[model samples]
Target: MPTFADPFQQHQAEQLLQPVLIRVVDNLRKAMEASNWIGTYEEHLLWPEGTTTAEQEQVRQIAAQLEDADPEAAQHLQEQLSHLPMPFPGYELRLSQGEHTQRIDVWNLCYQVCFTHYDPDTPAEVDPHLLDEVGDVDWLALDEKAQQLVQVAFEQLGEGRKD
Candidate 1:
């Protein structure tokens, strides 16, 4: 297995993983875009106490129309909304060393608006911590194929060197 004792090898491993990281991030962005309606629904939930019941009903009507018009999109949106009161999707990366391996995390934040809202001027008011409920990519939880690639990269770093 590759050991990250050497700086040069560590850099090389990071370089090798760059493309994979980019692809994952792109896929995440696409998923977020597809589920954009969740943002609007969440905004409605945050409406002030003075918000009229009729206005709330209008929100429900709009959601119903969206479901009728685009079932697939509506389903996607609903799936996201199910995780409600959570943060939006923003990209972040983290690297850590473990007892037997290195860990890389591709995380998300609510800093960026992941969905479209009814009114751009009025964005959802939410606590920042609530938006950090999900991690887009967690190295430790990756599939076998990805885990192997990462292991191989680390192993290569340990090549021709003693740690």
Candidate 2:
């Protein structure tokens, strides 16, 4: 039998990693789709900053720790939401309470709205000017093209039905 250091063995190991890598990418794409931040591109529905970047970093760390054959196992993780129009300009969705609101940027970046307390329990009578300070928004959620891709990914990721 060939030793672990053998070139042929390494090639076989690389081949074995292909499927796992594909699954990782698919799952990533699906997740990006379901998120509230929308993608900048209409074609592939890709987001590049904020939570997306954070997730990408996490995947990068995972792949770096894995064996050489699967070094890029978690690379290219993203999800596609859908092609629906966002509620606000440059923002897809707004999760808000009273005058406080959390806005998602064009690439899904989250900007915390703070002034009279952005906490959800804040009184509804809080000043509206604070909301203005929160500033204009970008894409709030993922694009529409990503919806189905996200569902498939979630199913494959072991998120089973409630029943």
Indicate which candidate wins on TM-score. 1
Clashes by residue pair, model 1? 1-155, 2-154, 2-155, 87-131
lDDT of 1 by residue, 1-163 (tens): 1234357534534443443454444444443344211111111134444556775565565566666767788877676545433322333322223332322223212111121221334532322221223623333323333334434433443422223
TM-score of 1: 0.21
Local lDDT at 69 for model 2: 41
Query: Superposing every Cα of model 1 onto the true structure, what RMSD results?
Result: 19.5
**RMSD value for candidate 2:** 23.2
> Number of clashing residue pairs in every model?
4, 26
Estimate every model's Cα lDDT from 0 to 1.
0.37, 0.32
- Tell me each candidate's TM-score: 0.21, 0.20
Q: How does candidate 2 fare on TM-score?
A: 0.20
- Tell me the deviation in Å of residue 77 in model 1: 50
